[model samples]
Target: MKNCPNCNAEIEDNFELCWNCNYSLTEQKIIDIKDLNENKKEIDCLRCHVLMLYSGEYKFHEGPKIGVLGNIFEAFVNRESFDLYMCPKCGKVEFFAPLQNSEYKFE
Candidate 1:
């Protein structure tokens, strides 16, 4: 905690404004993950005509996973990052994009 310049009150480092005094904190950036998620565009499947699912984020691993006895596993694991909306009828998967690009989007 640091002393507020205006009132000399102790303020947490993570906070933008001091609790005791309305002191402006500089050199801090506030990122809103919810706003970014809400603004992301959506895409739909053309064949299924239903909204696709948002598969999670994926990363490539260089080495294979070894079992207890040193058994090598070839296949990689699927990592889900974001929310996915899959088609109930066809089970098509899609990522968030733009409404114009997607076949299904809320008007």
Candidate 2:
């Protein structure tokens, strides 16, 4: 196990990025993922009532087959990506749809 330089969080040896603070060990710095939209909405933590920090973009990938209803389920719930936000104090995480391109078409 290794320690993250930024947040001092314990990290696995094989992992290059710090999960707690999003610090890149290889790059030796924190990864700042910014939103492309100029008028980005600031999210507040429901529990803490403090402004949430933008973590990064998270993408969902299809996993193994889920029996006969896998295709049908994927068709109905076809979300691909989302913007992740985290509360600095309470470690609360929230997911929001991409602000730049709100429309998503499954193809």
Candidate 3:
């Protein structure tokens, strides 16, 4: 097991990046689109109860700002908070959270 420099979380040796804090020891960043897409899950809207489609496409300093809550600076880099779920029918959206080992649930 390797320790992540950003969050200090224990990462699998096979994983190229840190899943907890997006830490990278390598210079070339290889984003696993399939793994990332599977990160978002769908659920009923809190207010409207409408079905939403969670989006996971965003860019840092251009899209949403992540880990900006409080004085928390757990990561070395600022990443874009990808909108995980959205209800186009109701126009509701929710940001993605750190998820580990949870299989993507699509409804």
The most accurate candidate by lDDT is: 2
Candidate 3: stretches off by over 4 Å? 1-39, 62-77, 98-107
| Candidate 3, lDDT over the whole model | 0.54
Name the weakest run of 10 consecutive residues (lDDT summed) in model 3.
Answer: 98-107
How close is every model to the real structure, measured as TM-score?
0.29, 0.47, 0.35
Candidate 1 lDDT trough over 10 residues, lowest sum = 27-36
| Tens-digit per-residue lDDT, 1-107, candidate 3 | 88777667787776556655444557445334344446466577787665455465554543333466533443455554345665433455676643542453344
Candidate 2 vs. true structure, TM-score: 0.47
Q: What is the C-alpha RMSD of each candidate to the true structure, in Å?
A: 14.1, 7.0, 16.9
lDDT tens digits, residue span 1-107, model 2:
88888888888786666767767788887765343222555877899886667767898866654799787677655457888877654667898877666484334
Per-residue CA lDDT of candidate 1, range 1-107, in tens? 67777677777676554444345466233323233245444445577554333344433445546766333444544432334544433555554433444443667
lDDT (0-100) at residue 93 of candidate 3?
Answer: 66
Query: Candidate 1 — which residues are off by over 4 angstroms?
Result: 1-37, 55-62, 69-85, 95-107
- How far residue 70's Cα lies from its native spot in candidate 2, in Å, is 16
Better of 1 and 2 by lDDT: 2
Q: Order the candidate numbers by TM-score, best to worst.
A: 2, 3, 1
lDDT of 1 at 86: 46
